[model samples]
Target chain A: MRAEETMNKLPANPERATLEGKNKFLGFWFFLGGETVLFASLFGVYLGLRKATNGGVTSQELFELPLVFIATMLLLTSSLTAVFATMSLKSQNFKAMIGWLVITVILGFSFLGLEIYEFNHYVHEYEHTIRSSAWGSAFYTLVGTHGAHVLFGVSWITLLIVRNFGRGLNLYNAPKFYVAALYWHFVDVVWVFIFTVVYLMGKVG
Target chain B: MGSHQNDSVSKHDQSHLDIHHKIAHQKELKQHIVSFAMMIFLTMLSFIAVASEAISTRFAILFILVLAGIQAAFQLYIWMHLSHKGHQYPTWGIFFGIGVAATCVAAGAAMIW
Candidate 1:
């Protein structure tokens, strides 16, 4: 049977669709919505505790714009690559989709690596640790949560690519790919906020 | 009976075509790129505002927060496609989420202050 025939045989309710596909798709988006709130709360707490640095290290003394700019570029470029991958998926160009996803995954990994390096530099050079003060705790919690999302996104996309390598795009997998792209975009969205509230505002303050 | 048969035949033909074969409009991709560029520019502008030393710290904080708000709006509407057609549910979900977030921020700030 053709792919459509296979999909047709699947159920209607998205949550109960065969291949356990649509269920994961709708469920994941809802999960991401919850995650947005989780990050939002963290951001609120961070903003409230922003001035609680206890004279450990102020924002201007700690943050370097160039490194952050590079990291921002990496993540923004990754978001574009993810869009390309989704486009390829829509066009049924599985090979091209996979290629774009590979690029996106690499960008995400490099972004995570840079974030780790950035954190280490802050801790070692600036003596900024999560335990340093309330600001340190809030800073790490907010930005670290975003970093964790990026790390999760990288791993999620990598797993999707590996699991669906031999299998081409079908309804069973299309929603999965679509939601993964959505999650990637969400990560980028959160970073945009982080860049503004944490880095830029921190610098100004 | 004959009309019914024709209807079934057409449905059969349509079902064979995969929706994924449709190419996304190039214009949409261009729009996304433009929006991404705008957000990057906004980010840089905030950085410049902070580094300039011309603005007072209080004003700088307020200005950067406004810029951040604008960038967040761009990311949501454009990158996340939250404002697009067929995304009504997600749009509502995110807005409701933002409302709660704003309240939390206000209350949290108040409590801490």
Candidate 2:
């Protein structure tokens, strides 16, 4: 009985307890590193063409702080919830982890909704769009790319939760949960730049 | 690799390990909450820096960018667990990406002129 108890015990970090888990964990970070470069290129293009409004609405005139602020808050809070999910994963509390992930997904959806509303408002009210001008194209591409990421994250977490609802926490699925949380956090990290360079910087000018 | 030895430990020792893990996780949780609060404060500060007319455009841009850097560090190191042990390779990967990203941003800025 004692031997079985020890055998059944989970490692402190069940996610990286095995070679496969370790590989998944490291590979995901490397993937995030690659993702950083991808977004950086987009950011570069946006910066170069940000001034070319081509008689369309300028960034300063088009951006509203309250909307952007709310979106940032939503995403930032979602990042925290994802962290909580990770903590729960570490402690092997499958239900709490799912609960936290659900909250994270909800926040992600809220952020995406705000982005859609913001884009629609810009198009209808100010005529700013991807086809409007260089600046318009740059703005939409950079911010829209981020919005798409939020959508992807929301979907990813939802699927993870649903698919794993019945499969309790174990080494097999623990790394998956950990990796998903990492991806969600990476999404938020990208937004930190977006809000700073795209929205906040645009407002400052 | 050595985790197999854990199977030989008595049940009482195993529970002790579990308790230790729980205590450590609790402490880590508190630190994460503190980091979260700091991030929120920084975000608000950046927004206010841009919203107010008191700060010049040049200064506000620089200030907010700095804040963004700090906030990103907090997320990466604390929330992402990059600060924990066994993250050496992950750190290298991320820094390399950031280095290349910096070059890309510089190139983009150079195109502006």
The TM-score of candidate 2 is: 0.96
**Model 2 lDDT tens row, B1-99:** 234444367668767777887789889989999999999999999999999999999999999999999999999999999999899999999999999
Count of clashes in candidate 1: 0
Worst 10 residues of 1 chain A by lDDT: A7-16
Clashing residue pairs, backbone N/CA/C < 3 A, model 1? none
Question: Could you list the CA RMSD of all candidates, in the order they appear?
Answer: 4.7, 1.8
Interface RMSD of each: 5.1, 2.2
Q: Which segments of model 1 are wrong by more than 4 Å?
A: A1-25, B1-24
Write down the TM-score for model 1: 0.84
User: Clash pairs of candidate 2?
Assistant: none
**In angstroms, how far off is A28's CA in candidate 1?**
3.2
Every candidate's DockQ is 0.37, 0.65
Q: Which residue ranges in model 2 land beyond 4 Å of their true spot?
A: A1-8, B1-5
Among these predicted structures, which one has the highest DockQ?
A: 2
> How would you class the docking of model 2?
medium
**Model 1 C-alpha lDDT per residue in residues B37-75, reported as the tens digit of each score:** 887788787778888878788887787788878877877
